[model samples]
Target chain A: AQSVTQLDSQVPVFEEAPVELRCNYSSSVSVYLFWYVQYPNQGLQLLLKYLSGSTLVESINGFEAEFNKSQTSFHLRKPSVHISDTAEYFCAVSERNFNKFYFGSGTKLNVKP
Target chain B: DAGITQSPRHKVTETGTPVTLRCHQTENHRYMYWYRQDPGHGLRLIHYSYGVKDTDKGEVSDGYSVSRSKTEDFLLTLESATSSQTSVYFCAIRVLAGGLNTGELFFGEGSRLTVL
Candidate 1:
């Protein structure tokens, strides 16, 4: 079974400041990584995903994540964040065979104005 | 939008009562899943269906049961609701592209159940 670990439970940052959310997974086999964001009183929405390729994956909203095989980590980063980016972000991992997805505890990104 | 709808968006029930939550999808997707979201536990899968009548248990399936009779409908049932079962439940469908699972999911608004 694969397990996802998100180191931070809450991250507070000022608007326009850079932010990073850490995610790590435990799996020996190849896996897929994903980030989902949930706004207040709504379901989660897919932020971005890493299937394969250059190890660097990005989303349309200026957020990017790097898949580091050695560290078994996929950390999401954004050079500058907005107030709208304030949401609970969840990190998920799925095996290459496309079984089930395991989600982390989630990190609440609070962007203050 | 994926056109996924979960019934009884908010419900208040008592322990020992039978509860059923329905997930309806307009798209005829082959896979549907049920997950429960908690404060610190994130989301935990309860059950998933690959095809009609073909369902499998997930990590936290001890007290939950699911049935899929049609591709557009997936039902989750709790024989006897408990206080611990009070949580927001989400239904998701896997997005397939190029005859392969894209590893992406479209989730419903979620059904909030409160067992008092």
Candidate 2:
């Protein structure tokens, strides 16, 4: 079974300040990592995913996550945050070829302007 | 929304009543999922369908049942409403043919149901 842990439950940051959201996973085999954003009352939208390759994955919205095998972590980072970035972020993990997903509790990113 | 919509965007129902939430998607994706969102738990899968009439239970499928009669529609039913069932529900879809290469999934806006 694979599981994910999002280190922080809530993170408050000022606009334009760099922010990082920590995520870690526990699995016996290969796994895929994903970050999703949920605005207020909306469903989750895919922010970014790390399948394989450079270890660092980026989203079109200036968010990035790095896959660290040694640390079993995939932390999300943004150089400059905006108030619009305020939302509930989730980290999820799925084993290779599996349909079931394991999710972290979630982190509420409160970007104050 | 990825051509996916959930009916009854917000609802407040009394306990012990029956409720059924609908999810419609025009994308024709082969995989459909039902998830619930709460304060700290994030999104938890309640049920999922791989194809019409092919359904599976998820982590929190205890009091929920799902059915899919067509390709575009998936329904979640609560046998008897309970206060614990009150939360925002979301429906998501993913293409099956793409295999694991499908990087992301399309999500519906969401349906907020409150059981009073």
Candidate 3:
């Protein structure tokens, strides 16, 4: 079984400030990582994903996450976030044989104007 | 767009009553999934379908059932609705085959169900 841990429950910051959301996963073998975002009362939307690649993957919206093998972590970072970025963020992991998916509790990113 | 739509956008039901949610997609995605979101918890998969007539249980499948008889429609049923089942339900689709697979999921707006 695979599991994800998002230590932060909430993150508050001002507009244009840099932010980082931490995520950790427990898995025995190679796994696929993903970050999703959800606005108020809306369904989730994919922010980015890390498959078999250069440890670092990026989303067009300026969000990036690095797959750290040794640390068993994949954290999402944005150089600068806008008020529009205010939403809930989630981290998930799925293994090769996993038909089901596991998601972390979540990190609420509250961006203030 | 995921081209996915879930019917009964909002509903209020009583406990022990049976309820069914419908999801329709036009993208022809190979993988379709059902998830629920609750405060303080990330989305949890209730059930998922790989292909028509091929479905499997997820981490939180105890009170829910799902069936896929056609390519574009996936149905999720609550045998006996409970207060605990009162939450927002979302349907997601992903194309796992061919080069069209982006590994990214497309989600519907979600169906809000309140079980009294």
Most DockQ-accurate candidate: 1
Worst 10 contiguous positions by lDDT, candidate 3 chain B: B95-104
Error of 1 at A37 (Å): 0.6
Candidate 1 Cα errors over 4 Å, as ranges:
none
> Over the stretch B1-74, how does candidate 1's per-residue lDDT look in tens digits?
89999998999999999999999999799889999999999999999999999999999998899999999999
For residues A1-113, what per-residue lDDT tens digits would candidate 3 score against the true structure? 78899999999999999999999999998888999998987788889988786999999999999999999999999999999999999998877544556889999999998
**Candidate 3 regions with alpha-carbon error over 4 angstroms:** B96-101
Instruction: Give the interface RMSD of candidate 3.
Output: 1.7
What is the Å distance of residue A66 in model 1 from its true position?
0.2
Q: Which stretches of candidate 2 lie over 4 Å from their true place?
A: B96-100
lDDT of 2 by residue, B30-63 (tens): 7899999887787888998989999999989999
How much is B2 displaced in model 2, in angstroms?
A: 2.0
DockQ for every prediction shown: 0.86, 0.73, 0.71
Candidate 3, overall lDDT? 0.90
lDDT of the candidates, in the order given = 0.95, 0.89, 0.90
| DockQ class, candidate 2 | medium
Minimal lDDT window, size 10, model 1 chain A:
A93-102
Q: State which candidate has the highest lDDT.
A: 1
Question: How far out, in Å, is residue A112 in model 3?
Answer: 1.1
Q: What share of the reference contacts survives in each candidate?
A: 0.75, 0.78, 0.78
